[model samples]
Target: MDTPLINALEALKKENRISFHTPGHKKGRAYESMDDGGIQENLYQYDTTEVFGTDQLQDPTGAIKESQQWTARVFQSPEAYYLVNGSSAGVLAMILSQTKPGDEILLPRDVHQSVIHALILGDLTPRFIQPEIDPQFKIPKGITLPQVQEGLEKYPKCKGVLLTHPNYYGRPGEIREIRRMTREFGKILWVDQAHGAHLGLHPQLPLSGIDAGADLTVTSFHKTLPAMTQSAVLFAGGEVVDRERLLEQLNMHQSSSPSYILLASIEQGTRHYAKAGKEKMQVLLEAIESFEQKFRRLGLFQLDTAPGKDRTKIWIHTENSGRTGHEVETYLRENHGIDMEFSMPQGLLALTSIGNREKDLKKLYLAFEELEETLYNKVKMEKFSEKYSKEAKEGFFEKEVERDKKEPLGLPIRTAFYSRKERVSINKSVNRVAGSAVTPYPPGIPLILPGEAITRGHRDQLLEYEKRNIKVIGIKAGKIMVVAEE
Candidate 1:
């Protein structure tokens, strides 16, 4: 793996350059990482300031440019840029660069919290394409072409659509059809492919966003690939996205001093994918197949292999097996020393990649086998959801839906974000115009957004989530910020 970024860092460090750099570390001499048991010496050496050979990340001219070009080539993207600040930065950058405040951007309701933040920063009006919620898994499936068509038709002034190729639950969407429609309608297509970074690597994978002709596709390489956390890549697929403006937006969000270690990891991951992605993915697929066959016979767990879903992620539903997603997660962690990707209310998502070890998976199977016996011998148990919310006959999410039916947008999102607001208790927050997003952080989905009229039901749901220890952002010190009364 030829990492130009790492090579530059190593060569610069080997030369033993003197002081007089923006970074106060001065080549990790004064940094306590060397003395104390902090970051390794190699990281300190590699973590250099943007000196002569070390190219600037904002305006990549040398190694960064070369590395990104290789990345583009490997991914078959027209143009690509490194994102050190994760896909969150990429999502924000795309929205900021392409759409202006008050512009309408149609998207699915189940988007990441970062998208909500981006909507706020851009002050863009969001027209949500109602996602088909999976009855079995309770997760929102990706938007279809018909939904996109309806959104566009409903919101005539909508500039573009931001589609999440694969929802966090490993459900993929109709990217190719959506792309074709976006082109036909002369609308920009931004695919938030935070989970599809390794899509093109294997033939078994679903359609890659760039190949599907998305205007702008941003991927968090760390999510599914062997890249370091916070490592991501942004692509300018079509003429819709202005490359220079995208770069400018990236610079606005990205750190002035980017991490060489993360940049090098991105390069290395790309190189690895180019070399052995197919073979590795095949092995992973085979292993998963074997695992599934064995698990299916056990008659305990259920898998979500719905159409258009990613094969790399194993979505295990333990409802029939008498286990909650969190219980399964805890068992897998404490009993088997295996931490799953995420545990939703319906099921647990186990992330398997080309990099996953066979022995580790085998161990996971053994753990499941143990879990079956343990659960089998045990008496009847109450469901986690059932244990909570004695008052609400419907499930927690159903209550949320009932709340959402209360009212519509109070004002434009742009106006609401910029308006003078006051903090109020959850009880008093009803009928007040929301000044910010109230989101569930784990899934990173916002329940309510700025300018939306907060209802009593919405407040109750927020309180329930808080009581359950689930993080609800935008509520500070038992108060929610909302637009003040004139």
Candidate 2:
């Protein structure tokens, strides 16, 4: 029987698009020279149900145990668990394992959507700590030590501090300093190191979460390593995180019938990292540096960078290309046959990994060159400030929560998410307690949480997002559904 997913993937291949995007493998062609000897095929063979030798993921005792042990060693962590559900699972697990209901946790405003869901799931109050945003590119940067200190001073009762190291844009924060602050404040340091999975493998790269004093760190192995999609790892460090509690939470959040294919991919990817990752990543870095030199010469786009950020993930914003990220993404895919990892309103990003080769980099350079010529000759440069500007000057990172006298429209997210609920419009949602969390997708943090009073600022942001076709969850009729008074 033919599967729809498989058929669709085949159709995509038929389209012959050049993948500048993900799996970091780029159509599985870039890593062909690696001495896999078809070990990847062997891995596929073992992707079976939990048999006699294959152990269950939740209670690993056999091959899974060995794999997890190997992974721990690879990352230099006290222990590591292969997460079949992606880094999102590991993040949620950390939150659930560490905090209790009504407890406060310090979270960076620029964190992924998963963290917001985790906060709602755990019934924890988030003390939002803003990240530093580059004035030029409007890209969010890492939080500073002073900011962490101030947050800890203000919210001393916070149970933990959740930070994203090497944020989605590839800006690496000073993790060591942040970790020190968290420890001094007697709070756990939970790092979302989704983009830094390859850090430990390369000595020249920025430090990994495990090495930088993070208590519990989650990495999306699939993002930067040669792992299958949805494969991730959660590393436990120091005495901050209770390992047993983490294991229990992981079992709860992770799937019982875990995919052995994804597990084996992690195993193989870790082994690859242990053996040849350094040399491979070195070559990858060299290729990127070379590409940057050529990219600067073209001069149609400005590549955003921050001090101490990992150089592998290159984020490009057009200077006068007069195109939204959507338009540039379309131009690459339709005209140049190239696809990138993500195209936000501000810029387009290309994630380079050990999986990339000289030829792959060359192809990207050629595409950019063509893109420059096409935009210069055919497209009139459109100023994007008016189109992409934030709805309110209320800083994305620095916004403060104000308590309103309005009654809640719905129960807290913890209850509303698990309960049967219906959608409502934004205007009608004013007095009701929110039944769900409504957030912006790219940096998926909730603008409105369940049980929080809906302010006009929140409404305006949602409306602006709607105008731009940005989707918001837990709402109906341009309003959000909330718990009604019985």
Against the hidden reference, what TM-scores do the models get?
A: 0.85, 0.86
Error of 1 at 106 (Å): 1.2
Q: List per-prediction Cα lDDT, in the order shown.
A: 0.77, 0.75
lDDT per residue (tens digit) for residues 1-486 in model 1: 699999998977766533221122234332221231223446777778799998999898999899899989888888898999999999999888998888999998778878888887887888877788777666677888899999988888899999988877778889999989988888999999988887887676789898898989999887777666788999888887877789899999999989988887677668767776677778878888788877876667788878667877788877665455666786676556676766654568777766675665788788788777766766333323345323333455456445434356898876898899889998899889999888766666778888889988888877876665666788887788899889
lDDT of 2 by residue, 1-486 (tens): 679999998989999776655575555653565544354667667668988989889888888998899889877888888999999999999889988889988877667778878877788877777676676766777877888888889989999888888887888777888888787778898899988889886666777789996889999888888877888999888686777888999999899899987887788778778888888888988888888888887766777755577888888875345455656776677666777877655577888888877877788888789878766675533522443334223343222222112233345557766656566777556655666777665445566666666666666556656775765665555767666556
Error of 2 at 176 (Å): 0.7
In Å, residue 402's CA in model 2 sits off its true spot by: 16
Off by over 4 Å in 1: 1-41, 298-300, 321-323, 379-407
Clashing pairs in 1: none
